[model samples]
Target: MKLLRNILFTSTLLMSAFAAGTAANADPGRFMDMKKSVKAPIGHKQFCQDNGWACPRESYDPVVVQLNEELWQQLIAVNAEVNRRVKPMTDNDLFGKEEHWSYPVNGYGDCEEYVLEKQRVLMEAGWPKSALLITVAKDVQNSGHAVLTVRTDHGDMILDNQIEAVLPWYSTPYRYIKRQSASSPVAWTGIADTRVTTVSSVSR
Candidate 1:
């Protein structure tokens, strides 16, 4: 009788552990539901391969080169536009318009909106579908927001509307959670620091 009770307890614990693991790994279908919620495309496998610190590309296609150059130029233009538009607004202005910022729009957007818009424009400009990725992070103040990361042959560069210069990802202070990929749902390797939250977005 004692042996049977022990076996049953162990089996119950194991089953509970398995169920928890499955839920953790299951896809949440966020991409399918939020397809139109954001502008970028759904497929992100190639983007992950290209932007990862380790991958290498042989050479850029002529078309890719042209598109990259054009997109680079456009990113610069958009950064300038965002700075011009958002610089004057006080913190209260942003808080007051938080609802507008949350909704998707064709034109006119806040910081995150500007990033998403720029990402879409870059994709349309001919940059490799994988070259542009939308990264959502908590700002220094712990506010949730989005930014654009451009994966280049050398490394990933950040195009932030808050700053005119495009800096490398490591240079920025924002803590990374999970980046949106074209091919798969978001993944979190680890948090940058204790302040950074684990990825809260659902996988597709």
Candidate 2:
């Protein structure tokens, strides 16, 4: 009877460990819960118009990259490299406008510009356009900001100019507003962030 009880206890411990591991890794590719489509930001709309070649309006299969050590390292490297390379300046300082979204012209740009460059570099490196999205959010200061969201098996990761480390979307301090649709670059989808009491407008 003692041996039998010991065996049962060992079996229970093994099962419990397996369950915990499964729970920890569950939904590795889980995506954000998004709400209805929203209007693209004015700055992004204008950006599409000015840089027609960069904006493609066709629907395609959205991709979620399978994340691995190599891919995660790449994300870290790219995020750090860009954050180090670009000097941050407000849109008014760079373009003499309240809001302007474009690539950094002379190694200087605003938040959105850093997002643009990162998107460009990733896309050029063969990352699908569908997996890379331009996201708008309210920063810790409740001011508008932009960041690049990368869809992956490990969930949505954020690459930001203000932050040196690439982080999972939920770990960021910003209140997500909206982002480019995964199906089409021209479309936008609203993020259902419970933290947001009001759907405030974003300028970046």
Candidate 3:
């Protein structure tokens, strides 16, 4: 009787462990990629006004403003703000799990989703589309990851959720991969290094 009871208990424990593992693997939130940017048409006058100049201005002429230095400072400040908001979620917390209720840091987001959110917030804060670049690369671990690259006059800086401090692109261990254009909404074009295979629901 003792032997039978012990066997039954061990079998139950094994089944419970297997069920838990299966549940984790079956989670639906694991596959959501990042959201793509939306584009809308703008009239010539609206475009010009949005750009803060006349429509027929010279193509390559720089905008003449008195506070160019101050504008640059403000851009830097906004970048810092974005880093502050996203770093905690990416670095300290586990992937695909919410950390806090107030901030509501998304718990189950993949790398692409994180980048999308960061780009969206920065755009809302008035950063130019040209200033932000979405870069896709393989990290040191050879796992796929996406990060935001901020192009400045100095150099390109990477705002990764994996680290708190913003570092220049060349300083990181990631290999250089193709960057998503600020002007285009396409999720991918072609990679310079490796051929990427994108899978869709229909493929299955």
Candidate 4:
């Protein structure tokens, strides 16, 4: 049901959001500390190679800030554009191999590739490289998915390929897991469940 709804609603939502032109915290503390995370997802590593990413990710420091409104709009524009342009085709469909990740050289790639392009464009847009992270999460199906998580003074904002609506980390539907450490885009970390746990407590 969720998958069906996502497929059905994504294009509609994208059009509406564009027509409207519309677009966290102690969490900031951990992001500032930026602990070492698990090894980067294997798929991400391969994607970099296949895509010819400059490798050995730069910025060993975590970029921590609540992006100003203007910057937020820029990020939103790029996220929505790439999400709109790239059509999701699995590695098997595109490359005949399972678990392969790469650039959407032809704009036909899977989730992780969507993420890499978003991050790449964001960085190219002159956004700080350290703050824009290529993150991994568990989709509704419990399969590993990739997203671009932008850190800020308030918390984290998620730029996902699955949904055109950019969501606050706490509001997103996926189960939070780990993502690239803000310090280094290459190393990932087990995202503390703190954001969701606190929000749930407050709601109740």
Summing lDDT over every window of 10 consecutive residues in candidate 3, give the lowest-scoring window.
195-204
Clashing pairs in 4: 24-154, 24-155, 24-156, 25-28, 25-154, 37-188, 66-153
Superposed by TM-score, candidate 1 places the C-alpha of residue 44 at a distance from the truth, in angstroms, of 14
| Candidate with the greatest lDDT versus the true structure | 2
User: Where does model 3 exceed 4 Å of error?
Assistant: 1-108, 187-204
Kindly give the stretch of ten consecutive residues in candidate 1 with the minimal lDDT sum. 28-37
1-204 in candidate 2: lDDT tens per residue? 453344335434543544422222232223566889999999999999999999977899999997766676777787888888889899888899999899987999989889999999888888899999999998767789899999987678889987676766655566788999999999999987654444466754
Give the higher-TM-score candidate: 2 or 4: 2
> Which stretches of model 1 miss by more than 4 angstroms?
1-74, 82-107, 182-204
TM-score of 2: 0.82
CA-RMSD of model 4 = 9.7
Order by lDDT, highest first = 2, 4, 1, 3
Sum up the clashes in candidate 1.
6
Instruction: Compute each candidate's TM-score over C-alphas.
Output: 0.48, 0.82, 0.45, 0.74
Rank order (by TM-score, best first): 2, 4, 1, 3
For 44-151, candidate 4 gives per-residue lDDT tens digits of 677667655545666676676655667766767888999889998988989898887676858799987898888889888777777787776665555677888887
Candidate number with greatest TM-score? 2
Candidate achieving higher lDDT, 1 or 3: 1
